[model samples]
Target: MVVLAKAELEQIALPAAQPPMADVRAVDLSAAPGPDRAAAARTLVAACEEQGFFRVTGHGVPQELVRAVEAAAAGFFALPQAEKEGATGEPVGYGCKQIGDGGDLGWIEYLLLCLTSAGTVPAASFPFSTLPCAAVCTERELLEEYAAAVRRVACGLLELMAEGLGIEPADTISRLVADAESDNMLRVNHYPPAPRPEQQAGRLLTGFGEHTDPQIISVLRSNGTTGLEIAGRDGAWASVPPDADSFFINVGDALQVLTNGRFRSVKHRVVVSSERSRVSMIFLGGPPPGARLAPLPQLLGDGGGRSRYREFTWMEYKSCSHRGRLVDDRLRPFEN
Candidate 1:
């Protein structure tokens, strides 16, 4: 892996302004090309290639469900800090910066849960935990419903991605992510207003540091607060504003590996904005821990059939992220 110095790391962390937020492209999943799914697949290929991020509309998820989940999450976060921190579980439950070395990263709290057929796994089984607030139990039904809805959309997107790559919709990337056994999870993030909103070295203090996601794909719904940004091809950062009616799909490290870099794993971060508190939910679809991932031969483009990355399971890459720095390239260790 390439070792970056502090100055280089700081350079990578800087943010830049993008074109007007209204200019971002949106995809209609319900669009029909000759009464088939191929049209949406082709439309997404170009969009996905563009910085690995795009907005999705016509996703068929009910607005009432979205509101219900958001209300439930907000209620959970509204609890007293101590009450919110009372119940602990592995890799799931509530997390605040209070216990980690990331105190200076800015004000943020999150609830992480692993998805399963039976519903969300109990927080106790996660690798990390703080506590499950009373609201978690109260909101469990809503959370489960929300997860099912989002997971359906994610699976549809993966099918389109597979079709875009000229493979069977059910045989390619979808196969890795579309089952109950997949190690998919959802994270509900709340980024509160930071104490210092001033710029630091040309960047605002971040709620979450800049890094590419580790899953195959991530579907995000942000409340109407603007702070999400992605690193552009020019090495500058561009903010993706909150789109209430759309899901922002981000290609992750696993997809980058699967496509041999034809698509990208965008480096993104959440910066603290104005006094308005913000909420965003992310449903990350990934392969089961034991699944081996590598570039597909179909996507290698016949240049002697070489893959850009080596075969590695999601668990191997996840372990690297947990043990090493999150800002570092988690995929670098997997390159042959």
Candidate 2:
């Protein structure tokens, strides 16, 4: 709902203390690489090949802005129940109300905003990023400013991804230039302290549940919290910690599919602490509501560039996802 000029900010860059494995090293590498684009590109390729995620340094988003947003989200969620509930309920048909379920929760609040003025409301206005925030925090321009600034970083990333694929990075990213479905979202997720065990069930039954991103990719900035869990290659879950002044990158289903499994969309969840609160700013770049999603030309393995799957919009995929059943079940259909 707002936009800010890129000129009003200061950024600091830090080196990757060590080489990362298909991972974001909690540094800044957004619109421009910290040291060298070619070096950053190699790091990015290595990350997606193995880790499927990475932390970027030198993206120009201020750690202060990240702190401010997290603080605002915490303060907003800490408001009285009535105030918090005012922004809770959401339309069901669009699967928005699911965010409000699991009641008697901690003081975490959420706010989402749809950047593009595409196909009118009533049909598809319930974007996941624009969850409502407290009125006090609503008036601040930093949220929107941060979004626009990060968008540039996203564009740069997309193009870099293209280059990593051995194509003209600009050519692979052409669809994003004027495409309505090349969407981006910003969210402020707050986690308030939990009561004693007698009063709360703790993280397993509270806070945000386990979920994988539905976008092409997600970039996150979070305060030092240990609740995040990553499923390692052994099918075991490992707790992922936060590094100071860095962004976390994770691939989404769309990117995974488009890249013909070259990229992976991993499942992650937040575990709320019984004592300290947590807040994080998340940005997801996904295809538009109805943008057709399928494997990309270069990522396809065989048939001289044949795609492996049919194209489906995110809404379609989500509709099937809401059924809570795997779309491709083992029950074989009769061949005619």
Using lDDT as the measure, which candidate wins? 1
The true-versus-predicted C-alpha distance at residue 332 of model 1, in Å, is 1.2
Candidate 1 residue pairs in backbone clash: 87-131, 87-132, 88-131, 90-126, 90-127, 90-128, 91-126, 91-127, 91-128
RMSD of each: 5.3, 10.5
lDDT of 1 by residue, 92-178 (tens): 677874323322333478878888733365544432223355544557667777888888888888877777777764557776776
Query: Each candidate: what lDDT?
Result: 0.73, 0.55
lDDT of 2 by residue, 84-164 (tens): 455542431111113433322223446664444121122132332234554433534555666665666666666777776
The alpha-carbon lDDT assigned to residue 316 of candidate 1 equals: 88
Scanning candidate 2 in windows of ten residues, the lowest lDDT window is: 7-16
